[model samples]
Target: MNAAGFNPSERHPDLEMLDGYWSDGNQARLPINGVPECFIDLDPSHGTLTLSVPADGPEPDLARFRSIELATYTDGGDVWWEIRIQVDDSLHEAYSLLTRIADLVQLENQAVAVATYQALEAYRLLLASRGGMSDEQQTGLYGELLVLEHLLRTLSPELIVPAWMGPAKEEHDVALPDVHYEVKSTKGEHRRHMISGTQQLEPLRGVPLWLVSIQLTPTTPDAGRSLIDLVAVVRGLSGHRLPRVNELLVSAGWRDRDADLYDAHLTLRSKPRAYLIDLSFPALTDARIAQVVPSASLVRDVSYRVDVTQLDFAGPPSPMDAFVEIPEEKTE
Candidate 1:
């Protein structure tokens, strides 16, 4: 509570446990490393992240982190700033949302020189459409989660890219510095999958991209597992980073409480097949499209379904770390 007056606009959830929030005040104080206990507060009235910046202040280039706009409020000798954004209603989810931003600030404090807050996953949650998802979208999201579970189980936690769970507009589903992954889930038996854009499967010169295809068939209530089960699996495997993964899941249109709404049960049709996108892989690139199509503009919206039932699994670039290693140049 500010000595002068703590008339914060109240709207944020999960503040009942913090005293002074019930009747007199709308803000709750949270203590974190390096940042002052006075540095963090939530305006439950407006669902905003009310923070007091140190003398140095926040990152100057705020464009990278979208949706959240910084606002100022004058208090005696204190320069207070607030991170304001629209929030989803669930208490659990909103708490997860606040912690994500708080964690970023803590990380920024630890890394003094580097700006880790650029990984503004909260914005992804904010910008992620509240639009209803189709049955196919739910199934596909489940498929991606299963694969992520597999990767976490198989590879070092440091190797998996955090941004893979960000906006789906990325060229590949999951990416690392030297390698990337495009995950596709299908109910079709022929290993057929839809490619969203020309760039989805387009191979890069030095980077190795893998296309993982999982075939799932709907199962009876007694037989198959639901997405809720997979959500629990991801949460268990995610450990300390659950907030980050949850942010991604929420951004992908998943609500923990609404897991039952996604009640379709599915069983794997076969082992997931992964194909390395080398020069020999089949796909259309910008250069190739420009040569064949009459106008470059006409091919901009190109999308198609490719049947990979017969395509050979090129395997990983290296057998050492199958999940995330760059392909080594072939010897002549």
Candidate 2:
């Protein structure tokens, strides 16, 4: 039975005209007249409309909806975008959404990005919607994700997601078995980051704490990847821990359905720099404040910024080995 409440044999006679031509891996160009190419993609499960944006113009926002999926790919000499319905019961709603999107993108006066924005706005209006991440959150999440990706290479799949503690409101962004890391991101020329409280840089008992700083600069779309694209990369590399990672993402206030709302792309200003936070490291911890003030208990919510551009204390060459016990190399 289909969503229309009819079995295949009971399908209307007029609709039967599409059976031989559209079924069995076939497609037909839609009557939509525009600069972009549009087609009806027929498949075993349901019908799909593939909208090719024609040239190397602005890419479509890859927003994941409950009933549909939007994606793009490069074909031969041109870039192509497609939207497909995923739910059988919501076919009517999906068709209406896609057609409206088609109409928006096909207008001669609208820029591709503007068209895409309008289409995504339509999607949010019709589906379950949530507010998007702030600029600060986006940058911070990007840095944490880069560190998470780095950890994925060194830690076991089961241990990776559990180690990412940022979403859980832990003192550190990443708490591995051997070391804890405070990840920070900034767009300024100096290696400076805002610290919320003393606990952020405080080292754990008998454990080492390191701070990883990532600098990001705005760049053209052609040269950079959006936050959503980075998220997709992390998901692809998660292997068996995909579900756990997704849960962490949700706890961090990110949902796939809201991916379209973030379009700003950025590139790395420089490779990430890691510094070991030890006795000489420049930071105002509880112990440091206690040394100067007789009543350190009276102070609260200590927030400040630190510039580490000239920090001499550096981590292991391979940051993955930070705080992890490594046997000393034998010399003859």
Candidate 3:
């Protein structure tokens, strides 16, 4: 039987009671009269709890040392418990030392998670500013989507794995093979054709897919260049017809008017000819290629390096700088 309720001076009933022969700082055995129901002592400020029992116990029972449970209570009355298990006298001191070390490890892991979250938040803000979505009333909506993508990638790396690894069915059938993403951005209501397509060939099988949609607002007057948008478009092109690639790129102004249409040999160019570009093509098994085109050659990988600093912004009023400020009227 045990007692409940708080006792100001009395030790908590949950504490383990040890009875034995006491030495300088040890317990030898239980008293002949059996273990005591309760024991009292000042709470320890640190490390092991040192208890002393008289060495003359009626050949005290050391086993009683293993049954003790220590408890603590806050001034506000919340109770906490600690278990005390006895081992050979030689091992007790080492075990006590290890208990404190384990606690330190848990504290370190908590600190790591907190620091990572802060860094990730800062990166999110940087991406929003780079995408020109930092203004609130201007409907820079894509910033939020970019933030979400960064968050998901940082928190859950497995969500972006290829479909061959047993990814969910809905996500597996999309266009690109190595990247999976969804894009949401803002556009203008007056713009009839806001979304642009891609020039990349869709993977014949097992390609990753990404879906992107854009919303427009009047404040977004210069939200034209879509680098992130292009990423989404390419990822969604898996399994699309080869001819469709040329049509999409031609409509998007990616190729010159005289450029050959979607020829496997035609070099794809990114604007300004200054940025580095790389393309990944999906591998096709012999049977798969035979089904698509009996004599079609595999698409070779592509790479490009462009230097944009050489290109002039063109005109005293730069298009890229227009969003930096609104028109100001001169006072008389």
User: Which candidate comes out best when scored by lDDT?
Assistant: 2
Per-candidate TM vs. native? Answer: 0.57, 0.57, 0.17
Q: Candidate 2 has which clashing residue pairs, if any?
A: none
Q: Select the stronger candidate by lDDT from 2 and 3.
A: 2
lDDT of 2 by residue, 1-332 (tens): 32323231221122344455445545554445565655445453445534445543575555545545666777786676666654233433444455555565665456555665665565565454335667888899988988787777766668878888998888999887778889899988988999988899998876788888888998989999888888988898799889989988877778676787667889889766777888888888898999999899899999999998776535443556543233346699
Clashing pairs in 1: 10-44, 10-45, 10-46, 11-44, 11-45, 11-46, 12-44
Every candidate's lDDT: 0.62, 0.69, 0.27
Ranked candidates (TM-score, high to low):
2, 1, 3
Greater-TM-score candidate between 2 and 3: 2
Error at 137, model 2, angstroms: 0.6
lDDT of 1 by residue, 50-111 (tens): 44444244443444443345666667876555555444453333334444455545544533
Model 2 residue runs over 4 Å out of place are: 1-130, 317-332
Ranked candidates (lDDT, high to low): 2, 1, 3
TM-score of 1: 0.57
**What's the lDDT for candidate 3?**
0.27
